[model samples]
Target: MKKMKALIVAAAALSLSALLLAGCGGAPANDKKAEDKAPAKEEKTTLVVGLDNAYPPYGFIGDDGNLTGFDIDLATEVAERNGWDLELEAIDWDAKDALLNQGTINCIWNGFTMEGREGKYAFSKPYMHNEQVVVVKADSGIDSLEGLAGKNVMTQVDSAALDVLEDEEGQKALADTFAGGAAQTIGDYNNAFMQLESGTVDAVACDLSIADYQMAAKPDMFVKLEPLSTENYAVGFAKDGDQAMVDAVNKTLKEMYDDGTIAELCEKWGEYGITIDNWVLVD
Candidate 1:
């Protein structure tokens, strides 16, 4: 009987050891399986671009009621190159600064002018050229800057034209001739042209590209006056934005330019007078 009890005790001890070993050995495998089933870390890959969609050949609502333009196409390419998704935010032109400052938009990719706005925001390399010009009714009898004297003149709010009228020294003399005592600021070019067509305003000071588009779309209604001031277009970021982001955009733009993508897009928008022949990536 003593031998039998001792053998049974020994067998129990071995079984206990096996159970402990098995418990220890199985822990790591179970933990690895659990870890493998865990969800992956999600990364952000969406870029929100801000623009005055009312501005055509850059960004505008198409006849199909969809957003389409030169800037939109360029931005789509940039997003694709980075494996990111593009979200177009058609914003009020006058509120662009507010949008950027509040983090509502990632960047302004419209035909945004960079001259005279130094230190206001981080800028990408100038990618295109633009000129400010005045548009008047074909028979309004205003053919020159001098003809604008004592006439009701208007420009879109927060536009390069308004900036020139408000700040540039050489243009101040001409800006002072508006019939309203100062150049009136409209919400958008559409409104400015409406006021012009209705004879409420004598002329609309706007970008040369936009003027050309407007005139082409309504040939007999308006004609472009001589350019008021030449400027360059660049992407605008917040003043405190990440420089790395701007650098990334500049790099991509240069790549596009070198690969002839920029030229191709210019050709696509050539009817609107958009050109990139003078564009050399500003270092």
Candidate 2:
């Protein structure tokens, strides 16, 4: 009976050893299965671009009432390359600063000029250079910025034109000569041009790019006087002093310039010969 008990104990020990070996051999398989069934993860990327819905060629509402324009296309291309979802926001021109400051949007991607707005926001490297021109009827006999002197001139409120007219040493001298006869303030270039159309204003002082777009839109009715002032356009962000976004955009733009992408876009948009002078981080 003692011999039989010892044999049973040895059999039990052998069975336990076999069970331990099997468990150790299958451990890697369990781990591999868990790894294979792990949940898939999506990368986070979203760019919200803000713009005025009334500024055409740069940004405006299409016949479909959706925002579409050159700036919109440019921002969309950037987002696509960076694997980000693009959210084009139609915002009021007056609300741009507040919107950016409050983080309601990531950037003001409109045709935001760098003339008077410099130092007020974090700006991307200049992407395009443009001039301000006077728009008058074909028969208005206006041929120069000075021709608007003593005549009704129209520009948008808060526009570079207004600032230029107010500059102590700049074009303000020209407007100062006119003083009470200086350009009237309007809502936008559209309104300025409309005032010219209705003969309520003799001339309009605004950016050359918008004038070019207007010529493209209504070639027969309007003509440009001459380029008065020009400036580079930039992307504006909150004044957080962080330039990572501006730097990235500048780098991308440089790549675009090197690859002829900028040239192509300009030609496609009919803004050829308009190029950025320099791209550098200010802060």
Candidate 3:
């Protein structure tokens, strides 16, 4: 009888130990609940920036073969500040509109001109000033816009120069007088310069800063005429693009400018002669 009692007591002890083990397991359940209530990290949005990667000091492949430029740095900072990913896409400059319309890129963040392009896209505030200019061979004797009259003139396709050439108030008449039907448009500036080199074209109209860059590199090869028309540079989004994004970028850009980020970048690209230190956004 005593043995039987001992066995019962042993069984009772084992049952108690089992209950304790179950309670310990329940503590882990509470831990799991706590984990479930923790906040989840938000996913980042990628701001796919489209640009003509050949344009230097704005967006271009650097000596190290990585894409680097003034605009690139700003875009990266804006993306980081807004918790968005930065994506650089080198696109055909002429197809910038199509790319934006198709949502292939979020915005054109290169050296995009905003004067003639008003109402074409949702535009960010102008960040800098630019000018259209003519480039000719050193001995071409084209010292002014009038010198381009009746000459074979070419420019990059879809460039601000071409837009100016087409605008009635701009240089439309001058371009019409060129030997060709209109200003010959090439896919890139390199080819335009090549045409000028080969004497196939008498002159090339392009952005003043780009003309300066090319002239600086080949000092004895080319000469720039005085600016044809001055214009503002801004970021371009599709007409129906995300307004929220436009507002966000503009806010961030203002912050950067106030904090001197834009000034520092301008100084960094000072050799390119592009700066926005005194710029005031029209709206």
Candidate 4:
């Protein structure tokens, strides 16, 4: 009787141990199966685009007090097509290099000139052609670049027009004949126009597109002289930054051009000289 009781106890202990081990082993498999059935959370990419908000037809504050322009619209579309979250960062035009270097912004997209800055930034393919021109009041009688000589001319600081005026071999000879022997620099075009209106400056040197917008906004107020230099407009990325992003932008621009999205935008901003004729997408 003692042996039978002992054997029965041993059998019960072995069965309990087997059942516990089986339960422990099965729990992990069930947990793993449940884990496998769960959907993975997708990560999204955010593209931060830096631009001069005051630059009209490209990026600017409309009467609605919101950022809206050609580049803004183009960047928004690019972000949407790439499944990226878009962030438009308004930055000081002169401090663009620092912002790009610090990664505060991804790229400079507001009417950025790529002709003279090819070595400084990783530029996307040129999307449009631009010209640096001088603007004077209609009655100022500055019908040609020659008339700008010996005048108090002004241009935006760090702008392509200024660059042309500063280039010793370029339009610097013409700029040297100005009132101060050089073109005066300002922070923005609006201020330059204000100074021109107040007769503080004789003429304003700027991009033709900007001049066109200003002329249309205030008819019979300004006249654009001959072009100082012709250049191309492109997105400026940090030279050492993401080339992948530049390539992506280039691809998107090409796609936009093919699908007539760019043309539509040009039509919308036609008053600023942003037309399909200006678009020069090579490859």
Candidate 5:
């Protein structure tokens, strides 16, 4: 009877030990299995670009009613190459500074000018050359800047052309000779051209590339005077915004230039005077 009790007790102890060992060992195995079944997810980034939707050859609404243009295509390519999703925000040209500073948009990528704005924003390296000019009716008999005297000349509000014309050391003296002693401001190029077509405005000061597009689209309707001022196009970020992003864009632009991608884009927008020969990426 004693031996039987001892044997039974030993058997129970062995069974309990086995269960304890199984519980401890099975828990770790199950945990490892669960860990092996799950994977860490990769996060994707979204790149938001700001532009003037009415600005053509850079960014504009197409015949299909979708946003399309050189800057749009270029931004799309940059986003794709960087494995990012792209979002284009059409903004009021005059409100760009506020939007950029307020974080409403990431960066201004449309035919954004770099000169006279260097101190206000962190800009990518100049990618393309640009010129500011005045467009008039082909037969308006206004061949020179001096001819703009006492005429109602106009420019897009908050534009580089406006900057040039308003500069005291630049064209301000010439603008002072106009009817208002300054250029009238409009909301957009489309409106500026509309006013020109209706003969409400004597001339429209604008970028050369945009002028070229307008001229090509409506041949003989308008002609541009000699360039008022020359400048360069660049991507603009808020002065306090991401410098890394600017560096990334600069690097990508150079890569594009080297790999013939920029040349192709230039060819696509060649009608607007965007040619690889004008691309400023060297070495």
Candidate 6:
């Protein structure tokens, strides 16, 4: 009877050891199951950006039916890295503000200016600094801004440059300095350049990077006279506390700047990148 009791106790101890091992082993499986479902809760939303499809070097469509440009390409790469879908909406420049306000688009991811529109819209930290360069023919006698008097200068309709010319004091200054020459506003910046090309306008005032890109693409056709005013280019997000989108975009923009993506794009387009000190980066 004693021997039988000892064997029974030994079997019970073995069974208890098996039960303890089973519980410990099952704990790992439960932890792994919890991990498997964690990713499901981490899904994120894609971003949609609005831009003008005809703006070259910044954002535009290619002959291959692809939407490609400095901004478009950079934004797309950022979105892809973050597992976000990017919807590039081609909208009229005049409708840009309306679209953003109505949520028709999330943000204007283009070469938006921050100077004249100060405190007007919410802006991301400036991505690239630029200056407006004056364009003229190589043979034109116009070597500096001082010589623009009585000349027909061109700019884009509703552009900040036009504002610079129209502000009462600014307009008076322009008139007195340039012999009261008029600065006409065309439908697009390209039109202003074209007017210069066709000899219809004396000069074209445009972003230096853009003028460089245009001249490089069609060499021997343009001559950037001189830089007008330096400005910072940034993306426009919602004006309110839409900090989420701002954080995401500014994060990607900084990444691009650090990784030489922005510089590469400038070099690829053969335009000299502007220095940051000349313009401010609004966060």
Give every collision pair in model 4: none
The 10-residue segment with the lowest total lDDT in model 6:
272-281
Against the true structure, what is each candidate's TM-score?
0.84, 0.77, 0.83, 0.86, 0.86, 0.75
Ranking by TM-score: 4, 5, 1, 3, 2, 6
**Candidate 3 all-Cα RMSD:** 4.8
Query: Each candidate: what lDDT?
Result: 0.87, 0.76, 0.86, 0.90, 0.90, 0.72
> What tens digits encode model 6's per-residue C-alpha lDDT throughout 1-283?
9999999999999999989998887878988898988865665666779887767777777889888887787688878867788899998888888888888888887777677785767888877777767777767788877778888788776665666666674444663454345577676776677777888888776776667766776677777765667777888876873777778778876777677666666566544233333333333
lDDT of 3: 0.86
Candidate 6 to native Cα RMSD, angstroms: 9.5
Q: What CA root-mean-square deviation does each model show from the true structure?
A: 6.3, 8.1, 4.8, 6.3, 6.5, 9.5
Error of 1 at 6 (Å): 37
lDDT score for residue 2 of model 4: 100
- Which lDDT tens digits does candidate 2 get at residues 1-283? 9999999999999999989988887877888899999988987667788887777778887889788777787787777766778898887777778888888898888878886777788888777676777788888877776677788778887777777777876677777656374668888788778878899888787777778777777788889976667687788887784476667677776676677666666666664222333222223
Per-residue lDDT over 1-283 for candidate 3, one digit per residue giving the tens place of the 0 to 100 score = 9999999999999999989998888778988999999999888788999998887768888989999988899899999999898899999887888889999998999988999789899999887778899999999877887877789999988899998999899988888888875899888887788889999999998987788778877889999888879988888999998999999988998988888888788788877666665355524
Clashing pairs in 1: none
For candidate 2, the 10 contiguous residues with the lowest summed lDDT are: 272-281
Candidate 5 — which residues are off by over 4 angstroms?
1-42
Q: Write the per-residue lDDT of candidate 1 for residues 1-283, one digit (tens) a residue.
A: 9999999999999999989988886887988998999999888567789998888878999999999999999899988887778889999877888999998997999989999997999999888888999999999988898899999899988889998887757488788877866799878888888899999989999998889888878899999888889999899999998787788788888888889898899888888777777565734
The count of residue-pair clashes in candidate 2 stands at 0
> What local lDDT does model 5 show for residue 67?
99
Error of 4 at 231 (Å): 0.5
